[model samples]
Target: MFMEEVELFAVSALHNTATSPRLKELKVQQENDEVISRVLQYVRSGWPTYLPSHEILLRPYFECRSRLSTIDDILVLDSRIVIPHAERLAVLDKIHSGHLGITKCRSRAAQSVWWPNMSQQIAEMVKKCESCRKESNVQQPLSFVLSFLVVLGKN
Candidate 1:
């Protein structure tokens, strides 16, 4: 029912492009994304029939109030991926590329992503943004000096 409609939406979003490796990666990754595959399978399977004896980390995912979802086969929390730990920085890079401040970045990311500490992660990244800091420091207008104005008046 709803899952079928979601699958249709995913399929429709895909397109064939001639030159973009990113497009290719996007096309493939959306459908076969494997980062959270095991957890998804558990949810899809209505599981816990047999937990692996040594597996411990599955607890958190199992308890997530946010349900797993997908768009074009890519796993998502809402519109954003419930990203794995290794890919968090990369995700931040994409979200913060415009050099936005903490609040703006957090708002933008909220549209597409979610995690337990998402806002904190955005704040940390914004703090470390050298380019944004440098740009802010360089763009102020200089005020006219009173002595220079007096000298010009004499001229």
Candidate 2:
């Protein structure tokens, strides 16, 4: 059920003119990615039920086998683009461009793109950003605000 919503959003995102130029570049990059190419093949053909020792590297793709598919030759997981490893960093940058923090960045990424360990990568990126850390440190009032809310709720 949630996959349906994601697919709908992905289709809409692709139709959005603001991102078309970048999407074109992404398509070319995805095609050139050896791993993504192999994954695409797996998506097109039936995925093997069991991975031989040599195919161990594909375990991540295998895990989400049911959700994998292709739209216009671009591999997708449900409706989200299966970002190639080469583009993951760039995608993460765009996701965190507003410095909105880890949760928002992950939400933004979830809306349009995906890859293995995407949430973990977002957390790491936000943690490493000095500006984000400084902002987080200055949030001493957050605890006070929560306490105040709790006190008010008990009245």
Candidate 3:
């Protein structure tokens, strides 16, 4: 419960600072997420030996069951926040805000957030980004470009 209070305080502070307006919303959505709520219940109570077919949405998480946990009402995998479906686009925006390409964006996201198919999503997002497409080496083909000057004798 102490952690919950601290998280609430942090959210309040974030609100006051105007740093991240969406964080509070994320928490609310996380709490309201029926799937996550059930997952939390399972985590706190106990997971059954075998999940039935109806729980398809949760099947992805089952493999990493040991790493799932709760911080306040937010679900976390290992140390990374398990972003809900609704917030993934926003999170992706933040991840790609620097206009960094796919690899860097994936590395940045790996540090703090996660969701199923996140890598594929990131790739897709970057692929669809006009700016990224314009700047991509594939468009320019730098690899085949001749060197500006090939120095012949360098001992």
Candidate 4:
């Protein structure tokens, strides 16, 4: 989704807290640093109970933007850390397709990796996308006759 949409959704979420019971329930499903922080804030403000899990907090937030459901559904709270299932699936798909080596996959999955590899992976996926491939051409170099014709005078 576009960054504008994401920002707008986030702002809307913060603005209308009334329709957030589902959101609250979702957030309560996972425990993460952000959830803990919010929970702590609530406690400081005098709430007696601990905050819900990050997943609990995320459900309503994601539901607010349906496009994000695919990504949200795969996320799990593991010892307070959020894991992305899409990235894992992408890596697995790449490996299965013989596009990525196990070592490269592991390296790419590491926290500190930069954008180059990720961009490469995205490019590869785009190239392999059947819908896109069917509609697009893999442009090739013109033959000498075709190339030289442009230099010749028009009839």
Per-model TM against the reference: 0.53, 0.79, 0.73, 0.26
Clashing pairs in 2: none
Tell me the tens digit of each residue's lDDT in model 3 across 1-155. 22233344445443654424455566777778878777777877878889878998888787788889865556778767777777788788878877789999898787677788899999899989998877775555443343432333321
- If ranked by lDDT, best first, what sequence of candidates would result? 2, 3, 1, 4
Candidate with maximal lDDT: 2
Candidate with best TM-score: 2
- Which ranges in model 4 have alpha carbons more than 4 Å from their true place? 1-3, 7-116, 138-148
lDDT of 4 by residue, 32-92 (tens): 4464344334433543333245446633333322222111222222211122222334333
Candidates 2 and 4, the one with greater lDDT: 2
- Expressed as tens digits, the lDDT of each residue in 17-73 for candidate 1 is 132344335435433544356666665566475556554555555556257665544
- Once model 4 is optimally superposed onto the true structure by TM-score, how far is the C-alpha of residue 87 displaced, in angstroms? 7.0
lDDT of each: 0.59, 0.78, 0.72, 0.37
Better of 2 and 3 by TM-score: 2
> Distance from true position, residue 131, model 3, in Å?
0.5
Candidate 2: clashing residue pairs, number: 0
